[model samples]
Target: MLLLTIDSSAGASVALTRDGAPLDAWRTEQTTSHAEVLAPAVQRMMIGAGVTGADLDGVAVGVGPGPFTGLRVGLALAHALAEAWRKPLHGICSLDSLALRATDAGVEGEFLVATDARRREVYWAQYIRDEKGSRLVRGPFGASATDLPELPAVGAGLGLYPQELRPATMDEDPSAWVPDAAELGQLAEGALVGELHGVLCQARPLYLRESDAQVPVQMRQGGS
Candidate 1:
């Protein structure tokens, strides 16, 4: 299947995949420029791959437990492309991409996937990889690092609190890990083949908490 995938859970990333394999991908760790970078990056990836939106079977996106603004930028672009092309839209948990990367890197047994949630907390999930494949066993929870169950962990969360979370492997670099659009596309392909039922979700943001932006009480009371 031909797919266009996007992720802005940690940074802006875009990819084109054919039958679950990455054809091309692009990313930047600049978290604040998702809006400025995502759409243009998608266009470039598609052009470089010599394909167009109509050539894609579907659009896949990381529905994140991430920063609200970044997540919204990704989802909005994915929604626009899916609607414009009239292709199916699939939502893969951003954490799943990290777990997939860990498994690909030969991480065995069970491990934790955590990403920076800011405000002195993390977005975390647990996964186990057996012969069958990796499966999320618990959590996509948001919590303080001190509250997380001790485990070998991966993702940007570890970079922020290396003393609190163990690294999944000696070679693992905590700061370098973030969800990728290529990985999100692979998971979406698995879902299409019925190998990953219930893993794919509706095209919506998986928010862990209320957005920081809120109307002030006086404004709500029409007293402004």
Candidate 2:
């Protein structure tokens, strides 16, 4: 199956996958540039892979437990493409993608998977790695880094909260933190084949906290 996968919650990433394996991918490290980086990355991958939006069999997106802006941009684009192409779409948790990548990177023992949530907080989940795959142990919740359990840690949140959450060990530099598109596509494929259970959801941003954007005073007061 030809699939296009995208995750912009942490470090914006896009990829084209075939039958669950990645055919082409690109990721940008700038966390705030999702709107800027997303379109070109998607366009480049599809053009390089010699496919167009119409050629996609499905769209797989990382529905995020992330910051409001970056997460929304990715979901909107994925939904728009799906609607334009009249194709099926699946929404995978951004944390699941991080967990899958961490396991593949050889992180053992119980650890927390996290992403920078700004405002000195993180979106995190506890996981135990086994031969089959990662099992989500604790959360896809938002918490201050100081409140998280001290365990081995991975993802951008580690760097963001270094003074609070220490690592069990570091397999790679902290700069490598971000969701992986290949894993998201594998998850989407598993969802189709029934190898994985139902964790994916509709395209919605997991902004666990209130967005910084508040209703205008006039709107809130019903002034128009």
The candidate scoring highest on lDDT is: 1
C-alpha lDDT values of all predictions: 0.90, 0.83
lDDT tens readout by residue for model 2, 1-224: 88999988887888888888889888887777888889888888888888987888899999888888888999999998898889998998888887777777787778888788888788999988777666778678998988888788878787777787765465666434778778899888877777877657887788898999999999989996
Query: Each candidate: RMSD to true structure?
Result: 1.3, 2.0
The true-structure Cα RMSD of candidate 1 reads 1.3
Instruction: Provide the lDDT at 132 for model 1.
Output: 75
Candidate 1: give the clashing pairs.
Answer: none
The C-alpha TM-scores of every prediction are: 0.96, 0.91
lDDT of candidate model 2 versus the reference: 0.83
